[model samples]
Target: MERLSLTLALGDYEHTRDLATGQVPVQGVSLNVLTLAPEEAFFRFTFFREWEVSEMSMGKYVSLRSQEDKGITAIPVFPSRVFRQSMIYVREGGKIDRPEQLKGKRIGIPEWAQTAVIYSRGYLTHQAKVPLGSVEWVQAGVNQAGRVEKVKPKLPEGVRLRPEPQHSLNDMLLAGDIDAVLSARPPRGFGSGIRRLFPDYEAVEAAYFRETGIFPIMHVIVIKTDVLERHPWLAMSFYKAFEEAKRRSVERLSDITASHAPLAWLAPYTERMKNLFGEDFWPYGLEKNRTTLQAFVDFAFEQGVCHRRLELEELFPKQVLTSFKV
Candidate 1:
């Protein structure tokens, strides 16, 4: 029997860093691990940017998405914690009390970010009950000032919409051009910027329609269907390995934290990660997190991120799911 090779795509996140640094172990695997881009995981046998054509060329790819694109199997790799996306942030000295104060504040975010646009429109305006059209949205990217548009669902009548600006968001926020940012969790590198801008920073759950609908989906790991068919034992082995890794990850949380410093949202991040992983954070296939992943996929379809609702069974490795338990 030939040794297997698994190619993975990871994001620029801390947990991924832990995986790369060997702070976390894969456990019980001897396959060659190759790192690929966030998007190119689907293309096969493209080792180190070298393209090889074959039926099993791509091997197995695990990346981030609310769900896998059509024809691929997406396993819930990790449970993601939701955070705030706002326009104005108050530093050491500011008078902003709650969401209501956000009225008339200028906000900056990615124009095409579905999460930001949808959540702001649905959750913030409808649930928070902020004045309609109160947020002055400005479009900004890393290069060149951009344009803004209204993405919120329902707004109060007769509010004046300002001209969205073009500027780098961090630059604008630091320069006092934008009042807050409506985005996902701030990454570690940006932690200092967040602390400097909002020294009184706190993670507030946005008002969302959890009562009747699904929450937003962030990322999932997708496997090809054929791969599952060919390597029956591999899926179970991977799942078991990941489940153990997740367990180890939680058990050694203290060590992980000690090794990594200045993690402002450490407590909450760990708690959420633990919740998602449950007994294990790195479970490969069948974990309770699959339920949450299904809900997310359904919601993504409803919210238009995914074109249609994907069946959990169809999205996961069926062979592995039927056999694995944690």
Candidate 2:
């Protein structure tokens, strides 16, 4: 067997860095996965970029932006473990214990983030029965609060929107500026802040689709469509490897948890991911996720975030997904 050169987009978290950089040899497979945020993925995808990368990112937005482009393939894997806990953050100094108490309070979230803005908000409105418009939204960023691509049509009314570009939600929360901050995972070092807010704060189990009846999109692994055409077997091999990685990650979580002690919050998150990505959450390629994500595209289109709807074949490489499904 020949070793194929592959590039994966690794995130900035310490554990991911450890997986990407510190350990070169893992169970006989070596990946030169580069780390970058969603904003940087597009620039990194350029073929001539200095970074040696075969695959880059195609975030959920790609379903809208890359509708016609055909050179690359993207697979939406489980989001970086950090994202799993984003937006589900601690509410400090408030009488808000249950989801209902969140009403009329100020909520701080990252700017222009589609995941938390649309999906998380929708979860609160639809399942929790909270009146969406009643809460005030502060978009925290630098110089500018990120833009909301499109508001889902079904979001509850009376939601007041506030734009805060001067500081981050973490800073705002600690300073007593905001009632709650929405984060993917807990901010890097705010366990004390979380402790301050809710001494016994346990995570709230929430899923956008299950709660709101809409497919929520997040991160996934993408391979170039042409790559699959040339090497069909590689697709299955890659899928199987990640599945095993998930399994290895679960069975030996102590090793993973111990090795990546930097991510204290990740301890609980790993179990939820194991449940979702376990059998119910199959990396059976993209089909299962697609069925769910496409509905999101439809919702986005209906909400007017996207001008047009995307067909699965148009957005994804036709060859790979079809084979994976069959």
Candidate 3:
């Protein structure tokens, strides 16, 4: 049989390294991997359906899925995971010193439904006791002016979100127009005056993980519905290839002498990550990740990003949901 040829658009992640280079091959298929910046990929794929397969924002995916727009469906493959404690940027000597201090203040976000903002606000409202209704929310680009929300937002009842079409969050923060920012990207010209709200954010994030067991998910892999409908087996094949590629990537990094990571103590850090997380710290599939996935569903619905809460089985194909093993 002729191998199925497909295009996959994704970020240049360490895990996807082998697949990108063709060192890892998908079973019975040929892949054309297009490495794109995260912002570009998310926007292009979301609006245009530009690629047959893509790495898309979990928040946006869930939002679209909730609306019953079934252009694409996802597998369990997550390409990006980030801890959002450090994503929030605040002015030094500002009124907001702690997460709770954000209450009743102005908080700027690139998008209210951004995955980073979802996790940040989830921790704040659920853990730090910041009431969702207390603060006024502002939406705009972090650095550039006139950034617009690509998808229509479902802002919750009593949530105050003011969209600034004319100014950037960077300028707003510097000018004291907003008290703090919940952004995944740093503001342009970010320096001394502006700093992380938690100076010891690493410790804060590690503790949050210890307590919550959530390494917040960002992007997920999706296949166009038409392609999947025609080639149903491709879902499991793609999952297996991604898993294998990630395994090779891990093996290469764990080899101490090769210096796969730039840090001097990288191997030790890898071991520590093993101890802290698991043998495979970054895991795909549903069972190992249900808690994290469930939290995201709850967060998206609470923040009004998704019109309806969705479960994993509803979001992904049945084949990738479980595998038949030897």
TM-score of each: 0.55, 0.59, 0.98
lDDT of 3 by residue, 1-326 (tens): 99999989989998999898898888888889899998999889988888799999998899999999899999999999999999788887777778888888999999988888899999989998987889999999999988888677788889999999899999899889999988989887467578888888989999999999898999999999999999999899889999999998888778888788677877788898899999989999988899899999999899899898887789899988777869
Model 1 lDDT at residue 54: 16
Worst 10 residues of 2 by lDDT: 147-156
Each model's Cα RMSD: 8.1, 6.7, 1.0
Give the C-alpha miss distance for residue 182 in model 2, angstroms.
1.2
Assess each prediction's global lDDT (C-alpha) against the native.
0.45, 0.50, 0.89
Report the lDDT tens digits of candidate 2 across residue range 136-183: 777664223443322222222354556665566776776667777665
lDDT of 1 by residue, 1-326 (tens): 54555544544444344444445444433433445543343233323323211111111211112334334554545423333334334332445556566678876555423343444544446456665456676655522355342122222246343434545666666667666655443422244443333333333332232342333444444444466466555555555544455555555454544644476656567677555435443444444445545554443444344433455665555665666248
Candidate 2 achieves a global lDDT of 0.50
Better of 1 and 2 by TM-score: 2
Q: Each candidate: how many clashes? A: 22, 13, 0
Q: 2 or 3, which is superior by TM-score?
A: 3
Question: Model 3, stretches more than 4 Å misplaced?
Answer: none
